[model samples]
Target chain A: MISTHLPALQIILPLLAAPLCVILRNGTLTYWFAVVVAWLAFAVSALLLQEVNAIGVIAYKLGGWAPPWGIEYRIDLLNAYVLLIVSAIGALTVSYAKPSVDQEIGGDRGYLFYTAFLLCLAGLLGVTITGDAFNIFVFLEISSLSSYALIAMGRDRRALIASYRYLVFGTIGATFFLIGVGLLYQMTGTLNIADLGERVAAVGPNRTITVAFGFMAVGLAVKAALFPVHAWLPNAYAYAPSVATIFLAATATKVSIYVLIRTYFTIFHHDFSFGVMALGDIFMVFAVLAMLAGSAIAIFQTDIKRMLAYSSVAQIGYMVLGVSMATVLGLTGGMLHLFNHALIKGALFMAMGCVFYRTGSVSIESMRGLAARMPWTMAAFVAGGMSLIGVPLTVGFVSKWYLLLAAMEQNLWWILVFLIIASLMAIIYVWRVVEAAYFMPSSAGAPTDIQEAPMAMLVPMWVMVLANFYFGIDTKLSVGVATRAAKFLLGDAS
Target chain B: MEWPGLYNYWIAIFLMVTGLYLVMAPQNLVKKIVGLNVFQASVFVLYITMGKVTGGTAPIIAEGIEVYSNPLPHVLILTAIVVGVATTAVGLALVVRINESFGTIEEDEIRELEEAQEDAS
Candidate 1:
């Protein structure tokens, strides 16, 4: 007799756990409690995903009211995948946070850090689980607020500025998103996304609807760090605490991409203003620019964290490429890439955290001969980098393969060329670290002796890297579900 | 367009664009955050106005209530408003931290200092 309210509890459990972290006020206790909550959330997400897979779709009306009247929570394959991503990242990072956070943040701020972490984890989970559009906004704010705080907690002074830039851009993004929602409500008089979809389909081709569509599209584009609007990302990731960087990098923009997919392909039918022409053409252009520009820029960065941060932009291009294709396989590639890139980047950033933990810096030049010093950490880095380069037997390769197939399906051979060129650029950037850390002599500040990161960090880091390999070969978890989910979304939108 | 039908939206757009410009173009972090607040407030107004039906009254649970504009948008905006406040509080907290560490809230000055530090390092 487990009810569908379990989805709400999955999110609320973490949200409620944050305050307890504050009251406890001990870093160790708070950290462990957060980890437990995250694990519990992961279990809940698994159960929800299972329930959805068994049933057609699980829709629960809040407060026992019917949809189109009251808020609801929908658990389908699409969001179930997202729920798994955010909650799994939450669980892993909190498990990995003990050593990385201890090294990066001060003791007095530790409890507060875990509190913000829980809120963020809850926000992301809530965003994935909610069926109501307004609920989406509420959860988005919860996540965004915690993200800003988490970024600002960096010991470096640059963290403040990075957080500020993120705040400005993130706020603008959220505002535009709200304006779009407002316009849709004005026209349709419903805040439920499922209801809005029905109403919008009933009354189409209006000026206000078109404008609202634009606003939400652009807002989500910015939030997803698409091309020109991604300026806030590198600095934010670079300056944030390592645990926060890994968590936010792996989940925040991915969830934003989820929102983008949901909006364009779910709430607004494909027949809207751009339909195929504008939506496909615009996203294709931006995805190409982001792919090349992000890789080119990443190649020049001296800082390891900054390089990975830029690489995230390039990876986002892969997801958007699938979106631009506007086919089921294309959307499948996009959604699966969203899940895959999170795995790769989470591992990469955690490796950086290991470096930060030991040497207290992530500058490439200073990382000379790291393979000799911290063999396990460098091995994790290499594995993650290979996945990023789209080597076979890795999640990254599977995603890019599908994306290439999608582009081929659309008969866009040039995008295939562009994607390969971008992967080459990724190689150059990734090679810089390999040469610096594995070949060159250690730099001036390099410790005479290098020590591996603690068990807490190393174990979680390897788990993600291994998951990348596991899912790459299996393909069932990442590919099968994404394909089905894409069909559902594309069919529903049409 | 009627006297106030579509034209009201025109005003909302103006205020929104102006607020967005302030948030994006300003060099001062505090001013930028203030601009963000303004921008979000404009959105709230847009949602409220959108909820207002021509002859409809406030949506209420009354005996034999006949017509109400729409309470859904109003409820949605309430959630958005709380989110807006939370964002403001986080922004102000960051500004306070920045002022403490760098002794300034000006974006350019902060960037220049960071550049210098990067160079020296």
Candidate 2:
């Protein structure tokens, strides 16, 4: 009986714990409370994934009401994989957050921080698990709003402007998404994703659907921080409190990419989305530009956190490029990268968070010759940096390998050239930190008395770094789930 | 294709375009928030207008009522309105904080201040 409602509990557990954090009031208590809640959410997602693997699709009618009329929490291999990623990151980020949050945000506002973190977690999980199109909009706003609050809580005054800019852009993206949902509902009487999928196919190649598609694509593009529309990301990530940056970098935009995949592959038939609309060609162009331009921009950023944020945009391009291929292999690469990049980027950001914790700055100048003092933290950064560069025996290489095979399948040699150049750019950016931290003498302004970040921080950061290699070497779980999910999206279901 | 019948859509499009322009072109942070509100309000109008059934009364179960407009879009829009209000609250709160910190609400002024701070650092 408890097993039947796991889908709903997966979201409700975090949503309810959010207010309880405020009630708890004490910073340490709220920290432990959030940690427990996050882990419980992770356990619930694990069970949900197990159940999904056992049973093909788990569609729990929310409130016992039928799907077309009432909301439904639906989980397939695709979203179950995403749910696990979000919750796992939530758990790790929450555990790592106590030290960082206390140092940066102060204990006075700790409860508020945890509250927003839980809300953002629940929102991302809801966005991934829901089958109702309109439900996605509601949860997307919940996440985005909470995240804006989270970003604004940063000590830097620039965080305020970053959060505000994010607010304006994120609101526009969500409203555009609402308009798209409204148009879909106008055309089709039902708002259930499956029902809309069927009805939209029946409506067949109409102007309204095309317009809705455009609106949704653009809206999600903003959410995912896809190129050109990604102006809000670098500052937001750089200025937001370390905990918020770690969590949002790992999960928020990845969930948006998942939504993009769902819209492109599952809700609308592939033929209509790609063949008639020719969105594949359009996305391909933008994806290539994002890869090149985002990476190129990352090379110029002096702030480590902002550089990773720009790197995220470039990595998003990789996922989009894979999806634009519209083949099972391509989508598998995209999905795998979605999971692997989360691990890789999560570790990198956490390392920077540690740097921020110790030296009170994340600027490259501060990192000069700091590897000797913060050996574990800098080592984790090096491991994560290698993964980011797609070095062999790391998670990044696994996903890039799949992306390469997918590109080759389509005989797209030019895409291969782009991928190699982007990878080289990743090396350049990562090496800048390596050279400063390992080779250059400590700058006079650099703090002489800084020690390693606390064990609480280093442990979680190392867990992520190790997992990057574990998953990379043992590709069975990540690759297996991604392949199944990819096939499911392409309607192969094998 | 009946131009006269689609006046509601025309209004929604106009508001959307105008609201978007306000959001993008405004140098003042508060104006951008206002622009965001107008932009969201346009989407609300689009949703609410689409829900209206011509020659239909309010959605209600009554003995004499024959045709009722769709209630779903209205319900959806009601939720969207709440979201929009929350967004406005957050946006305005952020603007207040921005003003307090930078002592100016103009976007360009804040940028200048930030750049100066960066340069000094």
Q: What is the lDDT of residue B14 in candidate 1?
A: 85
Candidate with best TM-score: 2
Local accuracy of candidate 2 as per-residue lDDT tens digits, A1-494: 89889999999999999999999999999999999999999999999999899978998999989989999888999999999999999999999998899988899889999999999999999999999999999999999999999999999999999999999989988888888888989999888998888999999868899999999999999999888899999899999999999999999999999999988787788988889888889999899999999999999988899999999999999999888989999999999999999999999999999999999988889989999999999999999999999999999999999999999999999999999999999999999999999998999866689998999998999999999999999999899999998887787845
For model 1, what is the alpha-carbon lDDT of residue A98? 90
How high is the CA lDDT of each candidate model? 0.87, 0.93
Candidate 2, pairs of clashing residues: none
Docking class for candidate 1: high
By summed lDDT, the worst window of 10 consecutive residues in model 2 chain A runs over: A485-494
- Stretches > 4 Å off in candidate 2: B1-3
